[model samples]
Target: MRGLVWDGSELALVDDLLHRPPGPGEVVVEIATAGLCHSDLNPIDGKITQEVPVVLGHEAVGRIVERGPGVRLPIGTRVVLSVFRPCGACEHCRAGRRTACRRTAEPAATPFSRDGLPVQQFVRTGAFAERTVVSQSQAIPIPEELPDAEAAMLGCATVTAFGAVEERARVRRGETVLVVGAGGIGLNVVLAARAAGAGRIIVCDRNPRKHDIAVACGATDFFVTPEASDVAKACLDTVPDGADAAFECVGRADLLNATIASLGWGGRAVIVGLPSADTELSLRIRSLFHDKALLGCRMGSVDPRTALPELARRALAGEFSLTPLVTRVAPPSEAGDLIADLRRGELERGFFDLRGV
Candidate 1:
């Protein structure tokens, strides 16, 4: 099978990429489409450390072509991929801590190879290929009505946004919410806050071009500035008491600090962005005195196998916006190019249409 593989130094298309069949509690999915995200660049560009010769995608939607032992889903069932594979027996999984799953953090096994050598995985998933294997828990079935391109995003961006608002912040009705960085993920955060009935949703970003799109997604106001201090001030002024919840979707230390400062008394700032490895933010320690909380978000704290179906129902009901998030679709040949686009902030959300391959 053909796949985009990244060695330690460069990315290249390899036609001999191979994946083994489903083992116990695993499923093999034929890729329909896979979404390209900013985090996908982490390994290839050394933004994050990862094993080399790995397939480079996680956010995707595909149909199950085979199932391993104990798997119940029938073949041909369409599903959204969840990159995190929790070892159900571990302490974290038993407590429903999906994101903290032990297996996802530390690699356990590789399912792919080329030239009889292992091809490492990114985020416990390697969906950038024609077919890939994943734990059964990582597969979430979706309704037939969900578009393939849109459903691909459910694996990461959508789930992460939903998790950030609902799990990390517990945003409730009539509260003021602020979302920093109105990119694909940030826009979803705005929409999620709106669905939760936030009285006012303020978005901050350097690009004024994204203001309209952010507003369309649920931003009641926007702060268009590159300076974090200026953006925070705008957000604070928009909500006199301070924002009830703020999401830092830009993975920069300065923006994260700004998001934390934008909070009102007892406000929560959830870091939803993936920052560089070993990166740390310097913040005002005294800020916590207002009962303000700073928290990190992972996959929106969502259990895809359980939560995806309901989210899909809400999406199908027009409660969540997906179309606006999906800006383009490209072939796998452009996978590397899309990664470059993601780094350049030129794409909202895009997918690799692997069905043609």
Candidate 2:
């Protein structure tokens, strides 16, 4: 099968790979569609370093083509896989904080491909491959009615934002929220906050093209960073006491700082973006003493089995839409160029179509 491979030197399409069947507690997914996310670009460009010869897609939807021992789901079930890995026996998992599972950082215990070399899974999902193996807990069943392209996104973007707002931040109804960066994750954050009944949702990004898109995605107002004079002041003017919560989705240290500054007294700032290793962020203690909080949210703190289906139901109900964010679609061969474009701020929020293969 043809899949994108990162072998330390560069990322390229490799067809000379071999996939093995699932082992105990694992299931094999024949990927139907995979979205090219900004996170995938991080390791490719050395922004985030990983073991070489790794398959690099973390967000995707697939069909259960094969199952190993101890797995309950039937074959041919359509599913969306979660990037978060939970060890059922871990203290965190036992306490129901699977999002913060104590064993997540341990080396991946499953395998995807083997030949003269073994391939590592990026984020433990590696959905870029034609068929990948994951633990049963990673698979989330989806309704047959949902399109693969749309369902593919719910696995990552939707569930992550939903977890960030609902589980991590605990954003309350009538609270004001400001989401910085209107990319895949940021756009979802805007929508989730709205779904949670946020009173005023303000979105900030450097891209002016996203203004209409943000408002349509539930942003009450949109602000472009560079030209928006006194962004924090402007946001406070809208909420008087400032936004009750702010989310930084771009993963840049500077934007993280700015988002924290935009929060009101007793406000919470959630960092959902994955920043580069060299990136550094800081805040003043005096300001934090005013009851402000800085939080780190991972994959929206949601169980894919639950949140993915709920997000799909909401999209089907016309309450939230992911269509507006898809700015382009291309095959896996074009991935290198797509990553280059995304790095230059040329690609907008959206999915890249790789199903033609």
Candidate 3:
């Protein structure tokens, strides 16, 4: 089998990779499409450290081609692979806090190898490869009618956005929302906020080119600002008192601080982006005194078993369209350049059509 392997130094296509057969309660999926996410760039740029010789990619849709003992999902079933696979018996999972499950922090099993050396899976679902093994619980079934590229995004970006707006921020109808960054996750935050019946949705990004799509995704206003410090002012210029909720999707300390500052009294600011391991925040302590909250969101605080299916249903019903969010689709061999394009803000969202691999 062939897979995109990050070997501690660079990402390369290794055609000689070996795919380990599924063990008990596991399944092997033939990846159809995989979304290129900003999170995938963290390991490559040293923002996040990971074990080398690992397959990278967490957002993907695929079909089950092989199943191990105890697997109940039928072969040929289409599924959206989830990033979190919480152990049901863990204390957090028992308390309905699956994202905080202790097992999620443990090292995931490596089901791929090169030259007999085990290759770890990034975020436990290495969907960048032609095929990858995942625990049965991590493979959430989606309707076959959903497009592969769109379904792939539901695994991460869409879910994360919905989780931030609906679960973390608890945005209410007719409330105002401010989103920083207009990239993949940021745009989805706009869409999710709109679906939640937000009255005025404002989006801020450095890229003026993203304005059209941001508006299409339900932003009532878009602001292009070169400085992160100007975000709060721009947002307040429109809302006066400030927005009801703010989401920072760019993962920069400055942007997060600006997002917090853009919230009104009793407003909530949700951190939807993943910052570097060394990133720190500088804040005015008094800014959060007015019943304001600074919240941290992990995987949109969602349970994929229910969330993915509901998101799929909404998409199929035309409540929101995912096709507009996808800006490019290419083969896996172009993954490197595409990732760089994403890093440079040259693309809104890109995908890898792994079916040809």
The whole-model lDDT of each prediction reads 0.86, 0.81, 0.91
Question: Could you give candidate 1's per-residue lDDT for residues 1-357 as a string of tens digits?
Answer: 998899988888788988888899999999999998888888866887687878989899999999999999999999999877777888878887777786766665889999999998778788888999988888889999999888888778888998899988999999999899988899888889999999999988898888878888988998787798887889877777788899999899988888888889999999998889788887779987799999987788867777788888899999976898888899888876787777676778888998857
Pairs of colliding residues, candidate 3: none
* Rank by lDDT (best first): 3, 1, 2
In angstroms, the error of model 1 at 31 is 0.9
Model 3 CA RMSD to the hidden true structure, in angstroms:
1.1
Question: Compared with the true structure, what per-residue lDDT tens digits does model 2 show for residues 1-357?
Answer: 777888888888887766777888889888888887888877767887788889889788888989999999999999988887688897878777777786765677547565767888898888887888888888888888777777888888888888899888889999999998888888889989998999999988888877887888898988787743456765877777888888889887777777777888889999899888788777677767778889887788765666788888888887877776666666777887777776666555545454535
Instruction: Summarize candidate 3's per-residue lDDT along 1-357 as a digit string, tens digits.
Output: 888999888889889888888999999999999999988887888888788878999999999999999999999999999978788787778877888886875777789888888898998998899999999989999999999999999989999999999999999999999999999999999999999999999999999988999999999999998999889999999999999999999889999989998999999999988889888998899999999999999889988888999999999999999999888999889987898899888787899999868
On TM-score, the leading prediction is 3
Candidate 2's C-alpha runs over 4 A off are 227-230, 346-348, 352-356
Q: Who is ahead in TM-score, 1 or 3?
A: 3
Model 2 poorest 10 in a row by lDDT: 348-357
Off by over 4 Å in 1: none
Q: How far off is residue 170 in model 2, in Å?
A: 2.1
Model 3 lDDT-worst window of ten: 100-109
